[model samples]
Structure formats: C-alpha cells, structure tokens
Target: MPVWRRYLVRDASGRMVELPSRALDKAEDGTSPIPGFAGRCVDVVAAVLVAERGQSPQVAEVSFTKLYFDKSGFVDTGKRERMIRLMLESVADKRLARIPNAARAEAAVRAGAARLQLADEFAWQPGPAEMNEVMLRLDHRPAGQGHTVH
Candidate 1:
C-alpha cells in the first residue's frame, strides 16, 4: 500500500487544521501555470480553512514544515481546482465546505493573508514565495522549539 502524507497547520487556538495533501500537480508537458508549491503550505492551508469558517487567521507559530503520514508520501502539483473542490466536498468539517469553489477558497487565503499582515506581494497567492514569507513571519523560535512535523 502507498503511504499517505497529510499536510497540516495550527489555528490561533492551537488546533490542528488539516489541508489537502496534493493540491497541485505538474502538467505532462512540464509546464504548469500554478507553481508546484501552490496550496501546499501549511499556513496558507490553515488560513483558508479559518477564513472559510468566517474566523480570524491568527494562526499559531507553526511554520517551516508540513505534516506527513508515516514520514513519507507523494506530492502532486498541477491544476488544483478539482482537488480543492474534492477536498471541500470530503472534508469532515462541513463548515469549510461553504466556499463552493476553489477560487473562493483562494480568495479566503488572500483574505487570511491580509489578516496576518503579510506583505502585499506574498499575500496575493499560495506559492513558494508566499510560503517563504509566511515561514519567515511565523518562525519566531528555533527550528526544534514548537510542534514537530514528520
């Protein structure tokens, strides 16, 4: 059986927020409009979930690492609309299913980014740039201080 990896982040109240494992995938031709890291960042994922629930995105001080199942799994990057829709449909929390589409979810991410006070450049989307900015913003302690990611 294939090992499954689960990406996750923490809310302001320190609650774990789960995110879609493979939110994007590379095209067969090796060119994807959306970068590979889009939708895979734990902070952005948590922000999307919180914003979807109409709550604040004051996420906890967790960054730099995303969760994985059994310490191993696959990562796909491509057109992510379908996966986002599927995740919304299948998520255990019905509240997060209210966004209705990936675009809305992405909007929530942007809103959450604004709430978090990220720079305008990084706040607009979910990609390596945003991830790096968020990680730098949230990474207050040393690498091994907070929750351990595996």
Candidate 2:
C-alpha cells in the first residue's frame, strides 16, 4: 500500500475509498456548499507542505496520520473529522503559523474536505469576539518547544 493509503478511513457502512478527483476540484474551486476540510484527503496537502514550506515530513505525517485510526486500532472516519475541527479551533494558527501560508493551505484543506462530504468536519474561523480570546491564548504559549499540539 502507498503511504497515502494509510490515511484512508472507513465510513459508517464500513466502506473505505480514495478521494475522487472531481471532489478535489470542487473543493479547490470553492464550488462546495460547505466550508470544511476533508479529513481523509489531507495526505497530499501535508506532503506538499513538507515539500514546499520546509515543514518536517515526520512531523507532518505524525500529526495527520492520527486522524485515520480509532481507539480499537480500526480505520474510522466517524470522529476523525471532529478532531480536525478541534485542531483548527484550538491551536492550528499558532502551532502552524511558522510554516509560511500554512493557514491558507489548511483552510483550503478544510474546504475541500467539506466539499467532498467524506467527513462531516467543518472549518473554523474565529469571529471578532473570539479573536481576542484566541490571541490571548496564543500569546501565553512558549515558542519552538517542538511538540505537536494535536
């Protein structure tokens, strides 16, 4: 199996499938009805981040591959999406900001995921009221600790 195949997850019907190109196009072009990232389709994007932005491959793989497996060691797409949204909501901006254009890339990932309907995950953007809270939280964290938040 290819490295990317390791990131595939089974849906509610126990069906595991690759992300189709049409869905990818829809996500990339902003034609989808929702605004979120597809959890299972992020392997390529993660690879690109590592290749272009100097992000560590091991770091990217470890951070993303966790989304595909369940507590029982089975492939599960069910809650993987929730994890993705939580990652975005909690610390993605601060944690990934050092990587240039990381935010936009991540947003696109989320949008594409949403478009594919592979997972129910949605992208999160802090509102005006929440921005201050988010900034405050980020301001308190130390830098370059070399720990993956999610």
Candidate 3:
C-alpha cells in the first residue's frame, strides 16, 4: 500500500478555506483539476482536523488547497487510476453543497484518496535531479527513492 502525506494551513476557527496547491492532472471525477495551485487540498486537511478535534471550532471558513504531493512510492498504476477515478466520482456526485463543514472536509479526503491512487500508478524511473525539479516546480515530493512526480 502507498500513502501520500498532505500539508495544509488553517486559522484558529478551523474552517477549511485555502487552496495551497493546484492540480497536476484532470480526471473524470475532477480529482486533480487545474494545473496549478487552485484546488481543495486544504479542505481535506480541515476534515482531518475536524475528525481529530471531535467538534467544530469557532474558526472562520477557509478554502482547501494542495501544498505538495508527499509521495510514499510507486505501486500498481492500474489500480491507482481506478481508485482515483472512483473516489473523485464519489465526491463529485455527493450532495456536498448542503453538507456541513465537517462533512465537506470528509468529502475532500475521499477525493484526495482518489488523486493519490492515480499518483501511485506512475513508475519509479526518474533521477534525483528530475525528482528535485518536480518538487521545486510543483511542490510535489516523490514517494519512492528513485521515483519522480510526472
């Protein structure tokens, strides 16, 4: 199994309200939409915070964004792609518009899981320099030792 560590910034009130990074790719379910920092990674983190805190805070509303892709390693591409697609679809189809802030955060996690799945599909074949370049350019840290973010 592979995992991606997601970083996020939030305020004292704890509302998910920031887009830290942009999507590198676009999937049917809109997993990684936009090529730059303009998505909902922060929402995912907010959901996590809400879960951890076990109650809503007084923080103002915040947007979720992806700061970077902290990769664990490459696994099965086929499975990853399928998972990402499924997760995105699930989140997209859900009635999030009416959901509470905490629920919306959970939805972001589901969506992120799918995105991570797609990322895991890539093969580990890039050099350190190349990987560094991706990290510097996109804030994406490759997962595997020799893997690079594409």
Candidate 4:
C-alpha cells in the first residue's frame, strides 16, 4: 500500500470529495478579500474618478493596471491615493507650494484597514479651508467644453 494518503474535504452540500489545492483556495472560507489597490474598491474608485474627470476610460484602465497590477495580488490603494492627494500642490501664478510633510501625515491616517464609502457623488478633493490657501490649481476646460464641477 502507498504511504501517502489523499486529502479530502467536505463541500457545502455535505459531500466528501478530494480536490486540488487550487480548488481549495477558491472555497468560501479559504479566500480573503484583498483591500486597496488591486481589489474591488480600487476598480470602483478608479472608475468614478476617471468618469468624473471626463478622462479616457481606456487610459484609466491601463493606468490602473500599470500602477497596481503586478505579479502579486496585493497593494495598499488607500495610502497610495491619500499620499497622491496629500502631495498635491498649487502650480498657479508661477508659484509652487507643496503640502508640508504630506506623506507622513496621510500615512498616519491610512494605516488601518477601513472600507471606503462609495456613492454616486464620490469626490476626494484635498485642500485648505481658506480658498486663498488652496494648494493645487485646476486647469480650465477648453472653450466650449462646458466643464461642470461634480
């Protein structure tokens, strides 16, 4: 008799059967939802952001893939997004003023695993309370483009 034994598991229907590790990995309890960059939330966030900006969807997908999709299935999209927002600076009036230590400050807030609240009108604009202290400058749409703030 062979010394090695076949491993078996019970299915949801209460049936005992032998399955490969790959199948086991796909089981309800075996898989855990990935958070951030490459997860479901990232797709939603990217989709909303691109659409709101009237950006090309193809470019948005390619950009998302390039930034988050690597060999592994893990990325912290929250901190990445927050850092990008925090690093935003104004480039208007021929002057540039960056947020002071934006990365460190945002990182402290984005360290935990919290679910992002998505909605029809989801917007993530980082800025100062006073209008004059705005760190970033947005470009005006071309003439007749009819740009509307969401």
After superposing candidate 1 on the true structure, give the runs of residues whose Cα lies further than 4 Å from its correct spot: 1-78, 92-138, 142-144, 148-150
Model 4: per-residue Cα lDDT over 50-114, one tens digit each: 23444422111101111232223343445446444433321121122354566545543443212
- Model 1, range 17-103, lDDT digits (tens) per residue? 554434422222233323333334333333211122343333343323332211112233222333344344433233555656886
Could you tell me every candidate's TM-score relative to the true structure?
A: 0.20, 0.22, 0.24, 0.17
On a 0 to 100 scale, what is the lDDT of residue 83 in model 3?
A: 51
Ranking by TM-score: 3, 2, 1, 4
Count of clashes in candidate 4 = 2
Candidate 4 stretches with Cα past 4 Å from truth are 1-66, 76-150
Best by TM-score: 3
RMSD for each of the candidates: 17.4, 16.6, 17.5, 21.6
**TM-score of model 2 vs. true structure:** 0.22
Q: What RMSD value applies to candidate 1?
A: 17.4
- Clash numbers, per candidate: 6, 5, 20, 2
| Model 2: per-residue Cα lDDT over 1-150, one tens digit each | 112211222244533334444554444444541122433432221111122244323222212232333333333445555655554544444455566686657855665654444323432223444333322322223344342322
